[model samples]
Target: MAAVTEPLLRTERMALRQVTRSDVDRLVLLNNDDGVMRYLDWRPPTREQVVAEVEILLKAYEVYPRHGQLIAELADSTFVGWFSLAVGADGPAAPELGYRLRTAHWGAGLATEGSQAMINYAFAELEAERVVAETMFVNAGSRRVMEKCGMRHIETFHVEFDNPLPGTELGEVRYQITREEWLVARTSR
Candidate 1:
């Protein structure tokens, strides 16, 4: 991992910053909302559970400088949602991208904007080897955001979920962009 210069990631209209324990209340609402958790395997977590999760991630920052979920906010400082960057899934060691937004912010393109920023940081700042993201096959919206970030579909695989959402039967799609590919993308732009 490399040192992060900017504490908050800025896009044209949003800011991506470290999530604080103070964000737990609103985060609970966001995490527990049925609509927000629709594509996930787990249901809404308790307030205490969310707080503990936040604390764990906060502690992780001490070792890995640029790894964690970033809380997204509007330029005006209104909380929107969170975007996550982590290492590997079950197999290879790669940066895994994930996010969840308030229903009110859906379809606003903030997902794509923030995702691109993170991808740029992964390759440009963290000196990452690869960045990957996965979403349910039916999650057209999430898939589109990954596509916009220059990630290509790498696979579609099945995973048994106890509380599988609609379209989980269609399997999950993994998307990725490698460092070499990212550099080519940048030079072509």
Candidate 2:
């Protein structure tokens, strides 16, 4: 068996690691949770969809060793959800940050903690030019987490979805922090 590697990122309450084949069921649960998927796909992903997504995420590691969706777990290995620092449409130099915690773990600051760690990794370890994130304008909680991570509001745009979620009319928001901004914030703290 291949030796398991250390986690990609660790925060006060989470250890973010590469998503393995074993994690698909839990990921399905997370994706299927109505509350958790509210601002996302708007419907639970089928098991096959989850499996395909995991395969794609796993392959991403080969192309970009520092980027891929990761599973988040507690010290005892309890599933919290997942996080990602992916090569965005802007390219590798500006990766996107994303996270999803089980509803049971919400409001405990885990999202903020995990997100801050991903931003730190993007700027400090990967030498990324910028880190970006987006969510529905109505997702105040996610917006606050991005703000706390030092990402400023950069854009508010809309995408026409055939079956849009309830707050889709309000548009979506983008938040970002440049490496320079991250460095300044790091020094100030």
Candidate 3:
């Protein structure tokens, strides 16, 4: 695995490290699992598809500043999932936060732990003015994770998905927190 330069985000249970080529095998396992992608549009990815996906992500990191996802790993170096702060289609400046983990790790607060670390990195390291997350309305687990990370629901909007999932008709909800809000929340604690 390629070492992340300088600083890294460490939670009580995991370290947020860059997703490198060395993680492709685990990536394939995670992405191909139905439990993980059930709420998303995409289905199981072939080995080749996973390879291409990794290539695309790596290239995006190379071409853009602070534009990549981190591979969440436990102290023992087991892959938990990937959490991202990538540029969103909302605009050139919009960076979206999201995560996808193996079902085995669900309901364990690992998602919130990794997410809070990235939220801090977004405001303190990347100097982002705001951070946002969106998910299908039926994804209560995801919605809770965002809320735990201090993001509040802003709106629910419908998106046309070529391969819609079960909750597609219910639309998607957006949640956000501005840097100002995050800082205040932090200090007030």
Best by TM-score: 2
Span of ten consecutive residues with least summed lDDT in model 3: 1-10
Candidate 2 colliding pairs, count:
0
Tens-digit per-residue lDDT, 1-189, candidate 1: 112234457888887888777888878988876589877756788899898998988887776757778988886677789888876553223789888999888888888888999898888877788999989999899999999999999999999877778898999999999999999999998
Q: State each model's CA lDDT, in order.
A: 0.83, 0.89, 0.84
Model 1 clash pairs? Answer: none
| Residue-by-residue lDDT tens digits, candidate 2, 18-131 | 888878889888887769988887688899998999899888899998898888889888889989998968988999999998999998999988998998888888989999
Which has the greatest lDDT?
2
TM-scores, one per candidate = 0.90, 0.95, 0.91
Tens digits of lDDT, candidate 3, 20-132: 78778888888876688878756778788878988888898786646578888887777788898987676425579989998889999999998898888888888788999
lDDT of 1 at 95: 81
Instruction: Give lDDT: candidate 3, residue 134.
Output: 90
Q: What is the lDDT of candidate 2?
A: 0.89
Off by over 4 Å in 3: 1-7, 90-93
Each candidate's root-mean-square deviation in Å?
4.0, 2.0, 2.2
- The true-versus-predicted C-alpha distance at residue 10 of model 3, in Å, is 1.2
| Candidates by TM-score, descending order | 2, 3, 1
